[model samples]
Target: MTEVDLHMHTTASDGMNRPSENVRMALEAGLSAIAITDHDTVAGYVEAAQAGQTLGITVVPGVEISTVAEGQDIHILGYYIDVNDERLLERLRQLRSTRENRNAMLLERLRELGLDITIEEVIEQAGKSASGDETIGRPHIASVLVSKGYVASVHEAFDRYLGKGGAAYVNPPRVSPFEAVDWIHEAGGAAVVAHPGLYQADELVERIVRHGADGIEAFHSDHTPEDESRYAEMAARLQVLVTAGSDFHGERNGHELHAPIGSRRIGAHVLEQLKARAK
Candidate 1:
């Protein structure tokens, strides 16, 4: 049985590990392949691929795009993406810039609620939790809150201020689900709905399929046995490919679902299927 983890992160986004380190970890864990599905950016693929080449482990060029569906956050994972696709790169650049503005707005809201943390503080916290190069996100801010004792845990920080309906919650700018799938296709990748278990809607799987999802993430670190069964059934019914991954973001205090690479046994055939779909 081959092992592959098709969902992972690096310092390019919120994960603590660098792309090279992620590859090294994969090799150490005896993974046959791993994907660098960093949030919204394929910037880490180059380093990961280089490391994979040296280590003889397959590195799948991938990205996880955050989108919105019926006001809920939806993540779409793209496998075998052309990392140099101009359209994808430009859109990711815009998203990163917008996220910076959103972080500022969130901080202002925190101030309104009497939390006097600065952006610098959040950056410092992220620096401690990141690989020296990363796009600052709410996790970094939540880490800052945790370090300051403003929240007992990252989950607490989110519940109190960052989560939806929290006092400091700021709506992020995101593309639509259809747009996300189309962009992944435009980049010559197979678009799969990521971690269907994370969404509250019971019909999200079918909805994503309707939006042209080529596959579904049937196995994820956050997914329970029941969730996996449900997603597996949905993928079968929808006649789409099934994928699995640990969604490794490296070890962090608040980052749940932190598993070593290849913790989920993704069949090698799944990789072959994704590659077949790749242009």
Candidate 2:
């Protein structure tokens, strides 16, 4: 009955917790294993792995790469990555550069719309580090809006301002999910399409799985029972692995986003399924 939540975030990306704190939280929740799937960076993995070693909780080296296709934001999860692959580092650096530009554009758009906000505010809210390279994303912006009462919740903030088609939403050029799949493989990792239900595009999800993705996240904190059943069936038909994750981004204003760490999990066996399927 051992379980693993293959997707979680930390301060390395947009999540509120630090890498060691995430591991300690996972241990408290009694998870047998977990992954630190930060966006566009593996900066948190080493800390998480060291903490996990001390706590006897298995840590999977992972990252959540930001990709775009068909004018929509998509995430591809990489598991068991080398964490020091030069190719992965070069590509992620490029993606983070694009993100920096887009964040500026988005903030300007919000300001034009008369919302008083700054990238510094967003970075401070994201828990800035000495390196100052933490990945600042829409979720961090959404939190600032929530704190300022411009939005009621992060979900609403996205719906009204930060998400796709929201007033200040700006998508810059980035890698496609297809390219990300190969990036994961080249980094000696397995790529899983992260949370297909959010996309509302099953055809594209199917294409990616068919296009050599190791799996799809069939179970997620945001997914309904139907989403789980549908994607699970799709994976079965396609004869690929099925994975689950909480997509936890830590709590804000006493609200735990995408649920808590162990809210959505699958048996530990799927990690094996992933390793076997990857290139």
Candidate 3:
């Protein structure tokens, strides 16, 4: 089947690869299409789209908007987005500001936990991969932890300090999933609930669908077979689109942070299904 991985990241957010590099990687992976779903930014998608055009691969314009509901972090993925939409850009700027506040609070908490880390170190680590408008985030913090020998790897860093419920984990105020769905709709994109299995809140996921999410990411790199089955069932029951993605965040010290591009894929025609909703 012609394949597409609908969720991915690049250095424009937290992934280690550059945006254009991701497009090249997609072509190498034999993918017919992929989305540049960087956290809260479309610059990666814009860059990848250009590169994909040159490389003859389909790059879907997308962004991953972080949201919160029921004290859990949820991400709403937007496909076929208007990258230049002024309102979307302004909202993203606000979200980035909120992320800054979150970072400060997280840093203070980590310091209190006796870690010898700083914002400069995080910025330096992020700059190693980032180029233009990249959003520095917890992954960079994990990189700092690994570099300082505080953790052996990014996954270990998250397991010990950075992930939800870890000693240093902090969640600041952020927008709701409902609001994110509205934002995607206003920007003329199909909104998909990202990695619902990670959230572990069936009621909250159901509520987001009821609130008008256009799709659910049923297949993801981190999801178990049970998770995929459950969400696919839910999507079918709700009459919403079921999507698949690798959630590809490049590598750290040669180990994949998430999954390789095309690791979890769906038919390329699913891209048209999403675009149809977007239209």
Local distance difference test, candidate 1: 0.84
lDDT (Cα, tens digit) per residue for candidate 1, span 1-279: 877889999878888888999999998888889999988888789999999999998999999887877777788999998888898888887767767788999999998888889988887767643222246788888888878778888788888899887889987667877798999998999999998888867686688787788998989888899999998999898888989988887766756635777777687789989978664
Model 2 C-alpha RMSD to native: 1.4
User: How well does each candidate superpose onto the true structure, as a TM-score?
Assistant: 0.93, 0.96, 0.97
Off by over 4 Å in 3: 128-132
User: TM-score: which is higher, 2 or 3?
Assistant: 3
Give one digit per residue, the lDDT tens place, for model 2 in 196-245.
99999999999998888988899998888999999999989998788999
lDDT of each: 0.84, 0.89, 0.89
| Candidate 1: Cα lDDT at 154 | 79
Q: Which portions of model 1 show Cα errors greater than 4 Å? A: 128-134, 253-257
What's the lDDT for residue 60 in model 3?
89
lDDT of 3 by residue, 1-279 (tens): 899999999988889998899888888899988899999988677678889889999988999999888888999999998999999998998888788788888889889988988888888888853333568899888888888988888899889898987999888889999999999999999999999999989889999998899899999999999999999999999999999999999897556888999899999888888889984
Q: What TM-score does candidate 1 reach? A: 0.93
> Best candidate per TM-score, number?
3
